[model samples]
Target: MPHVEWRGGTCRVKWWTGETLPNGRKRYESKGGFTDEDLALQHGMDMEYEVRHGVNITNRDGAMPMPEWLDAWYASLDLAHRSMVNYESVIRVHIKPYFSRHTVSEVSIMDHRAFKRHLADVLPSDNSRQSVLAVFSMAMEDAVNAGLRKTSPVERHRRRGKYKKKKRERKKDMPPGAVETLARNAHAVFGPAGYAFMWTMACTGMRPAELYGLTREYCYPSWPGSDLRADPDEADRYAEDMLRYGKGDGLLPAIRVERQVQYKDGGLQFFPPKYESSRTLVVPPFLAEMLERLLKEHESRWVFPSISGGNLRSANFDHKYWRPIADGAKEDEGPRRPGERLALPEVPAFAGKRLYLIRHGAKAWLDEDGHSRFAVESRMGHEVPGVEGVYSSMTVPMERAIMKSQQERWESLPDRLGDAIWG
Candidate 1:
């Protein structure tokens, strides 16, 4: 609503600015010096209408420079550490560089498309470009809510699945044999911890963060017992409750996934699993024994700490440990010296594939076993969408079936009792 009042014998127009003052009064923008009261009243009404309709760019925070807005918006976000990192990268590397001279409201649709083209030229894949653009679109949409822009320049119709492009190749699961091969390779590189780490992740379908975050208390046949609570009796009771009441085999080993690790502020930090999907995963008999052995031999709080004996940094592990295991260690520079040749042949099954594929492989194995969709997805730390997720549940039969299938797969492998590949 707008008001016209006489000020110093001239008409003045005032309207609420859609903001409240510090004193809890309505903030207003006013213009004076109109000799005609009706004219002043009309002008105030027009301004009010524009403000109400989101056509007024003069509102608070509407004209901030793009770079400043980007920084402020980023600082205000409460997101996952990894997601924040990606957003920061997209803004710093792509957005701020191009839109540095513009205000939040000044990026037109043409500019948005051009910025996308620029990203296409620089980013390696369509997915990369899309991810970056999604970040920018989110920022612009937020700007509109903050009265920084009337509308986002990013077109919603251009988003993912708006048009079909190409069908992606079906990813293959790592069979028991391939998993063993990777374990052998990991053993050669990281010793027993490496061997067990590969097997644990492959068998459990654990995300890299989840696997890195694994601790002894979460491991089965041992968990709740390994808990370091001050009250030992409480732990004992909890253990009894968990062990005494399940179907199939009450003694079946399981891993309770309560948290995951990620790099935050230059240090490793524990966070709830993605989407807050804290779940307990059941493992096969062989995996249960494997994890128990690994825990016995494991020295650190982490099931698989980095070679430096600290919390595992994903990047460092990927480069130093995983790369050699998957791609095989090439001849080190010492090869140039007289007798310092050192190399490890890469595993063909994992050639050029990322470590996360191990999770994919595990999920694939569960699906191939023809278990209940809910059980499979739940075990993989994913929620089945829609009402199905609400009604469907993991039963003891489903869990037992999964365990049986995996054990059978293990039994099918040759050389099941072979000597260790590496010390």
Candidate 2:
């Protein structure tokens, strides 16, 4: 049995560790801060039970330095080389400098708050600070499990909790004809192919990876083969339209978005679209005609291929074409010198915006037209939520409405730009 004894004013609790030392003595542990004998006795019994059950716990009088614990914890991790390198970088740059000499058991709540304040000064944004804090907290959790400390000292918040939101103006979506403006700039930069690529991405709201991976097999004017099944109620209507589409006389055209090109094992590979959302996106009539022309003009497998006739890597495309098209390029300030090229004016709508914003712009356009939520979400490769999503399905009428609205938006472009596109 564990025991409690009064050594003058304060009482101490003692417990056997259920271990035997090399010298043939029983191993014991003790704590001596309790003033009440009854409390000390209860604590003694609890400690003895825990020790007998082999439950490892904090050593109140012993310590392990944070740096030592972090190194040990990292060494014990079995992770992919890339992931391990990332963790090591965070530990070396953000963690070790602040808590180098502190003990695992002595890192209190105040230290955590102080570290956060330090991070706020050193890190550029809240997200970056949180990411670093998460790495440190993960290490602290391992330390606790290793019995270097009783519990993690790092503060935690509910995943969705926000203490204070940063106040900033919402960015405006690209307006109706802004896509055409980008398409025009692209044409000026890389000729007809660039123009076609920009129009396709803007019109379909396809992710850059998905667009880069687009091949002849999945594009419009040829996809949605005759084998496609329509809702039973609309079977007759679907059959007539599909027959016409196959015969090259129909209005509806679609793209089957299945796979995207991504980097894996240091090489390009095909993976399912984000969230594995294999879908068919309807296209505007103008875009359909444009894609038809472009495909007929090229025999390559990809709908859009780089000069090397392979996948369009983002780094190369962005630097050589996208940036010049979006941000414009020219001499800094003085008069043009010899061998100086003429300037390219920045596309105002996309001057400081990202390429992914085009997807968001497409969504805004669909929503502005008051299309059904199911149809809009389906077109955007998003899964609708709640019972409505579970029970509802995209129908022929929904697709037709989307096509009509998109065609209208395309036709509304000014003749100055419209003439340039067609001519």
Candidate 3:
């Protein structure tokens, strides 16, 4: 039962919370500042109901500081290395400075509101502010679970329009004939291995990290046999090879995308692909032939290794090779300032495009071929929601359709680029 009384020109409700201390002292909770007795009593009854439903209301003494709680909560999380890196960055740069000294219970709704205002003023992008707020909210939720606070202040702030809709960004995709042009130019500028790498990405829709992770062991090509055909009964053999060699191939040389290379802790690290997008994608026959040639020439373990026979880093490749080829040549002008010179270059039609646009173009090609939604999504490593995703598997017909469509695209490249590609 809850009772309301008039106090300081406002109504206050008193209620007994079902909590006891070490010394057998019962805890009573109170809420104040209601305009009338009815409202105060109603709020009190709700609080009492929450207490009866096993909500912890004992630790409201502002004892556990936020920094300590955040550290413990972070340590307990079983997150990926990349996700953990983002969490650590948010905690150190945005969260700790503001809330480190304040106890969990002292962070009231008003304080949360103030923090949002501060974030709006200081942060340049809405996405950054939202990310910080999200991590802070998670930390507060952990505090509530630990009996350090009665309720999360973030929940109250959420109801007051803390979240606003952001303008969606338009997807960047390459135009028609762009992929073939880029691949032709890449071969001319960078060499045969670069040509194979670019064509493989465009044909298979693999992420840059996945491309970096490709190895000879994961490449299943129908080579050493001139007909480029796999034995009809080789599926079981391939499965056994996968168990022994960590990667196996089918009749057509398919690439198994089971891992990705990421930069962490000042070095490179290999982890499972994003969202565990582990699937084998059938390669276009012509592209498969090119990859075989590349492997023989390189004589390295990796399917696409750097000049030094090491794992290729996307950043280094982009800055040194991709930017120059995509953007074309530049001539430096006279100095505009004491230490600066102006360089003007004739930009190509696809100047600002990124390597990722090639992957998007691959998906566009699949969709244009009228493949089933499940096939497209699975090939792109996207999880389709609902029963369709769980019940459906990529069938042989789907893989064949994808392979045929991609092969057609590869065969048409010479016509699209004329002498630039065929020469």
Candidate 4:
């Protein structure tokens, strides 16, 4: 029962919260500063109803501040170093300042909605806003689970449709020949390792992080006999070639994508591939040869070490090596424009494209080759949904088919580029 009493021209409602401490102390809560006695009594009754309905309101009156709660929540999480860094950035930059003074109980659905609107107005990209909101929702969910709130205020459903539509409009896949051109140019500017990196990613559908994680030990020249098809003659020839090349007979050429590298804080950190997408992918012979050459020449342990003999950072690589080649520049090749200094020529075909397009190109190539959806998804480190994903495994035929398609692409590259690849 809730009762209101007048004190200093204000009405305060008092109620039993239906809880007791271990020492047998009854727990009660009070809400004060209401001008009307009836209103105060009604407020107290509403809280009592909430508690009766299994909504924990023990801290209703003394809810922890958002910043303090966020810090506690962050400390309790068991996330990877990279993920922890990202979460910290989001909390520091977006969430903390906005919700710092507010108690967990003070934030409502309306407040969340306004925060989202504010994000839309301030953030440059939809992805950024969504990421921040996702972190916020996760924190609020923790709050709800910890009994700090009755429900999460995040309205994910309200934003899903808009996000989906925007995703469709954004770049999905690369145009044909764009990857080959990029690779040739990359080779010219950044050398053989750059070319090998581009080709492997284009063919393997490996994420940038996965590419960075590649090691000499995990990279094989071929698949084992058990995983290969029952073509003894072909296997014999492959074995002979492997023996001649000093590579072991049992190992077939493949890349083991078990981990990924993420640049966090001030250095590179290694983490398991996203969604535990750790699987082996067969590499075409040409790519295997290229990787072999790269490994033999480079003294570093990483298959694709940066120019400074360190872990490859995606941002640094993009800005330094990828952009100049992809976008193009005349670079002191003499002036062409009248009354102008030096001419700046652009690679029209490569301009406005991104390094990530290589991954898209790989997906497109697989789809075009008519590979099984499961095999493609598996190769790309994506989880196939439902029973099909659970039961399905990459079969010999699927592997051979993908390998054959990639082999053809590799064989045709020289003809496609003619003189550009060497120059």
lDDT of 3 at 402: 82
The regions of model 1 sitting more than 4 angstroms off are: 1-48, 51-55, 59-61, 158-170, 227-241, 244-249, 330-343, 416-423
Error of model 1, residue 167, in angstroms: 6.1
- Full-model lDDT, candidate 4: 0.73
- Order the candidates by lDDT, highest first: 1, 2, 4, 3
Ranking according to TM-score, highest score first: 4, 1, 3, 2
Q: Which one wins by lDDT: 3 or 4?
A: 4
In model 2, the runs with Cα more than 4 Å from the true position are 1-46, 49-115, 130-163, 224-251, 331-342, 416-423
Task: List model 4 lDDT by residue over 271-386, tens digit each.
Answer: 78887777778777667777777777778777887655666675377666667667765653321122323323344544666667778768988999899889988998888999
> Which candidate do you rate higher for lDDT, 2 or 4?
2
Superposed model 3: Cα runs more than 4 Å off? 1-62, 120-126, 155-165, 188-190, 222-250, 264-266, 318-322, 329-350, 414-423
**Whose lDDT is higher: candidate 1's or candidate 4's?**
1
Task: Give the per-residue lDDT digits (tens) of candidate 1, residues 117-151.
Answer: 79868887777788888889899999988877879
After superposing candidate 4, which stretches have Cα over 4 Å from the reference?
A: 18-27, 49-54, 59-62, 156-164, 167-176, 222-251, 332-350, 414-423
- Per-residue error (Å), model 3, residue 382: 1.8
Candidate 3 Cα deviation (angstroms), residue 106: 2.8
Q: lDDT at 89 for candidate 1?
A: 92
Q: Predicted candidate 3: what Cα RMSD to the true structure?
A: 7.3
Global local distance difference test of model 2: 0.74
Candidates' lDDT values, in order?
Answer: 0.76, 0.74, 0.71, 0.73
Candidate achieving the largest TM-score: 4
Question: What pairs collide in candidate 2?
Answer: none
